[model samples]
Every structure is written in C-alpha cells, then in structure tokens.
Target: MNKWIRKSAVVLISVLTFGLITPTQLITNVNAENPSERDTVEGARLGSYGQEASYFNEAEVDKDKFIEDLVKQAEMQSYQKFGTRIKPVIENEFREIVMPNIEKALQEIANQFPTEDLLNLAITESPGKGQSEKIFNIKNNNTNTDVLRFHVRRDNPPQAGYWFNFHYHTYHDGFQSHHELGSIYWDKNTPPKWMS
Candidate 1:
C-alpha cells in the first residue's frame, strides 16, 4: 500500500509539472513564430497594452495631421479676430509675415511636447472681440491650461501708425514675455474694434 501511494504521488507530480510546463512552452513557441506577439505580451506585462498602446501609436501616426489641423484652426481664428472690417486691410501682410512665424512657433511647441501630450492640445474657439488683443490660445485639454497664447496687440508708437503686433506668450516663461511674430501696420486711424 505504501509503495502504491508513493507511485501515485510521483505520477500526480509529473502530471502537474507537465501541465505547468506545456502551456509555457507552447506560448514560447507561438511567440517565437510571431515576434510581434512577444512584444505585445511584454508590453501587456509592462502595463502598455490596450488603450495606452493604441494612444501612443495613434499619436505618432497622426501627429502631422493634428498639427496641420491646428494650424488651419489658428488661421481661421486669426481671420475671425480681424473681422470683415480689418481683415482685408491686413490680410496680405498677416499671411506673408505673421502667419509663417506662427506656424514655426507652433511647430517648435509641438516638438517640445511628447506625442501623447501633443495629441491633447486644442485651439480655443473664440478669439476675443473688440480691443482685447487675443487671437487664439493653444491649450492642453488634459490639464485645462494654455500652452501658448497668440495675441495681436495694437501698438501706437507715437509717430508710427497703429501697428498690429503679432506675438505669442508661452507657458515656459510663465506667459510673461512677448515673442514677436512680426507686425502689420494699420493706418494712422485706429483700426476697427477687433471682430467688428
């Protein structure tokens, strides 16, 4: 009876060991056949499986499209701020001088942020009306904070006519300093109230 019990124990141990090892070996073989599956498993183990992995991949793939869309929105917002009254007067200069700088600044800002963070960026819908000096702001949706603000201030430098000073403030500097993006000269007469 003792020998029979020992034999049964040995068989049970062997079956249990085989049960444990076979699945692992099968998984290893399957992973070896498709290396990407191995990466997926590893990624899953490292906590980057479903949503996070998809977000990272999508951000990388769609980054350029995202930036392009933001640029288009910026242009539209600027035009809206200029309104019908002031747009025709400054449109050409704004397009030629200020727009390029704005694009460059946006590109630089995109470079500073990670793909995930960049994906979360959004442009403010309404540019401030009247003499508010606000064109639009690029903000982080996740943080509910502005990353960069584009403004066109009417600067009257005594002898000079009203100049639309296109500038941006960045979160990096606590939004304090003006980073100029070239300026457009409005006539000596005060320009129409923004969005008028």
Candidate 2:
C-alpha cells in the first residue's frame, strides 16, 4: 500500500510539473536527436551563451593549422600586392628572401599567443591596389584590431633604382617601428605603380 501511494505521488508530481524535471531516458533521447542543441545549452550553462561551445573548448584546436593558413594567406596577399607587372620580376627573389622572414614572424606570433587566441586571428583579404604600402594585416576578429601589418614600400635610394622594402609592424610597438623582413630590387627603370 505504501509503495502504491509513493508511485501515485510521483506520477502526480510529474504530470503537474509537465516534465520540467524530465526522466534520464527522455533527456538522453532528446540529446541524441539534437546534439547541437545540447551543445548550445551546455555553452549557455558555461557562460558562453551566444558563441559555439566547441570554440570555447581549447582541446578542439588544430594547433599549427592556424599558422599554416595565415602563411598561405600572407603569400597570396604579397603576390596580390606585387600584381601582374611586378610579380614576374621579383617573384623568385621574394620567395627566396622575403618569405622565410614572414614565416618566422608568423611562427613568432603563434608562439606568443595561446592557441585559443590564435583562433580569433584572420588575414585581411584586399591588398592595396595602387601605390599603397599595404600587403595584408593579421587582425583579431573579436576586437577588429590589427595585430600585425605586412607592407612593402618602394624605396628609391638616390641612384639605386627601385627597391621593394618588405617589412612588418606589430601592435606591441604601436605599429611605428618597421621590423625589416628583407627587400627585392626592381630595376633602375622605375617599376610600374603597384598592382598596375
């Protein structure tokens, strides 16, 4: 008789609460049906409500993948800045001389920041088209601020034709100091305007 009464009370409470406190079996089935919803709820519970739960979990990161992607994007942006006319002439030298330093700089950045912070980094797409001294910038997506800027300036040192001075600036020094990567000589004939 006591067992029967206890069962009746349990059923009555469940009915009145409308499954607000669900059975473990029901929760398991619901979670299986919609795993993303579970993740979202978990994220909310962890105070990462709007953002994906996977992003907050550091274990999901690919480690070197972010740096590799950044390097590839940097190469593409450099070529874009060089354009058709300039690329043909300096492409070889740029690859041999400038690229290694760029890689080093990127690697340095990867080492400096935690992997989770690196995940927030992205390369700016559009390289400057004309005479602008912009190649690409590594920006933090969350803050919308540049963390590193790579640029090439046409330096004509008196009689020394044209030299593309490849360098980068970091946010650490307020983007004022030019940390030289290397330079590629164009010619005495004055190279065409960038991206021409």
Candidate 3:
C-alpha cells in the first residue's frame, strides 16, 4: 500500500474510535499527503510528484495526525473561552471542511517549492490571550518573502466568535514591514494564496 494511504487509513480508524470525527463526515477519497481532488495536467507539467522531495520522503509524513492534533487543541481552546461544550456538528465541520483547506494549501506549497528547501523551514507557535498563530518560516536568503502562517482566533469586545485564516507574509527590508499576500477564508470566495 502507498504510504499516504496506509497512514490515512490508520488516522481515520483512530479518529473514528476516539470520536474525533463522525463516520459521515469522513473524507473518503482524499489522500492525507495530497488532498487535492482534481488531477490537472499542469500539475504533471510542473513535475509535481517527480521532484525529489527527499526530506519529505525520508520519513513518513503523517499529515492527518498533524491536522487531528490541531483540531483537538482548537477544541480545547474553544471550550475554555466560550464555556460551552463543543458539539459533534462543529467537529464534523472542521473535519469535513477546514482540514481539507489546510491540506490543500500544504500541497500547493509543496508543488511551488523544492522539497529539500521546504524541509529546512522552521515551525513556530505564538499563543496569546485571544489569538494564536502557527508560523512556518520559509527561510529566504534575499528577502523574507517565504513565511506562511495560519491563525486561529476568537474576536473580542462586541463580536464574540471564532475565525480561522491561512495566509502568506512577505517582509520588506526597506520598509521594515511585512505585507500580507492574501488570505484563505472558510468561505469559497478565493483559493489559498499560499498556492500562488
């Protein structure tokens, strides 16, 4: 069996047994390693899978486990803030929708970058009072145009709700500032900028 297929099967079984996600909400056809539903010719033309992502291939990449860990952490965060029990429906939504978006973004990044270079990237987390961010430092020699961050946060004051975002940041040395490339919303309005 393929490595991704085997890992995905184990993750699914674990999630089902642990009640992290419902059986009806499971993503059946999506591979944990490559979550895209479409098989475009451009992907082939770009040498998507042929590239030697030796670092990523060196060890088994359990993407599903990463996603599941994030979900479990987020659920705890939500419960702490709202003092309300997280319902199965909410977990279902994250499992069926939010996770796939993140997975697809990672897949897009892999396509855009060399596997070995991406392997050198750094992962960091900043957890504050109301918001938390997970940052992937895409170390660039010339400029800091390679950072990817995902924010999971709740609004303050009047708006008391939760929102999640995945976006890229480009730092300008001249301006001593960073500019956002774009955002990936929960709604389907725009594809993730990380892919671009």
Candidate 4:
C-alpha cells in the first residue's frame, strides 16, 4: 500500500486501541519516504483547519487529556485529507494557526515525559517541513514545520520500582550577587523541584 494509506491504518488502530490522539501520524503522511507516502497527511492539515468547527469537539476526554487529544486529532485528520495540488494552502494553515495551539497545550501536560520527543514529532510531522526549530540537542531532523521538537528533564521516569523522598527536590535560596543566580526553567508553572 502507499504511505498515506499505511499511515491511515496506523492511526485508525492507534486511536481505537489507546483512545488517544496521535498527531504524528498526520505528520508522517507528509514525511513519507517514498514521496508518494507523504500525500494525504501533509496536505490536509493546512487545508482542513477552519472547515469543520465540530471537528475539535468530536472527541471529548475531559480536562487533562482534552487539549492533547484535540490538537492531535484535528491536525492528523486535516493533514490526511490534503491533496498535493492544493497542499501549499493546507500547509500554510498549519504553520500560522494549528501549531501554536498545540504548543501551549503541550506545555500544560508537563507530566514526566520529556517534551522533546513529542514536540520533535509535531515539527517533523507538521506541514511547514521543519519550520519550528528544536530548543534542545536531540537530533531527529525530519522536515515538517508543523511538528516541533523540544525536551523535558525530570528527576525520574515512572516505574522506577522504588520510592524515595527528597531525591529530586529543588528550592530557591537567598539572593546572591549579579552572576550568582543561574537561570532555572521551573518556576510556579513548573516549580523549583521536579515532583512528577
């Protein structure tokens, strides 16, 4: 089968199995190595953005997973339906509107998984063909602007098989000289210590 068709199959299976959205499949439709594989997904993400208002609401999973699923499904389905002849216009919508929403939402899901893998796929799979750049050094340069690559560093990953306290605690100390205070990524939004 062609690449787009294969991606479609993968998406169908994944969504049904996990009941979770997968935007990367849409991105892969564009990144199809065979060139022909990159047909469906690459084009439609841009094309379908504003067409169906109900598309975002079609699948509801409540608070934490809501934004993640919405972004994933909307982009995936849209990209899957785009045509090569009209893909340019479709890709444009992804760059301007679709991606930013995804970015903001992902930030809120900063559980424990590093943001890099997820963002990387978004950029690689996006229609922009690598328009978004990576903030970290993990190298997987697939060209798709809609997909963005970023990283998250937590003290531990789940299933460590053991428990310990004060292992990954971070805190703010008293003020120091101009050069003493280093730039920390976690604040109230993330907090000093990595808890999750």
- The top-ranked prediction according to TM-score is 2
Q: Note the residue pairs that clash in candidate 2.
A: none
Stretches off by above 4 angstroms in model 1 are: 1-60
**TM per candidate:** 0.69, 0.70, 0.34, 0.20
**Over 4 Å off in model 4, which ranges?**
1-62, 98-196
List pairs with backbone clashes in candidate 1.
Answer: none
- The whole-model C-alpha lDDT of candidate 1 against the native structure comes to 0.78
Residue 18 shift from truth in candidate 2, angstroms:
50
Total residue pair clashes for candidate 2:
0
Candidate 2 lDDT over 90-175, as tens digits, reads: 99999999999999998897788787776677788789877899999888778989999999999999998989999999999999
lDDT of 1 by residue, 1-196 (tens): 8657655555565588865434444444444555776676654433211123434454253556666767777899999998999999989999999989999998898888877666567788789998798899988877889999999998999998899899999999899999999988899998889998
At residue 170, give the lDDT of candidate 1. 98
Cα lDDT of model 3 by residue, 61-175, tens digit: 3444333433344434433332223223244565565556655554554455554344333333222332334333333333434444444332222333333433333333432
Write down the RMSD of all candidates, one decimal each: 19.2, 15.8, 13.7, 18.6
Total backbone collisions for each predicted model? 0, 0, 0, 27
* lDDT sort, best first: 1, 2, 3, 4
Identify the superior model by TM-score, candidate 1 or candidate 4: 1
| Residue 95 Cα positional deviation in candidate 1, in Å, after optimal superposition | 0.6
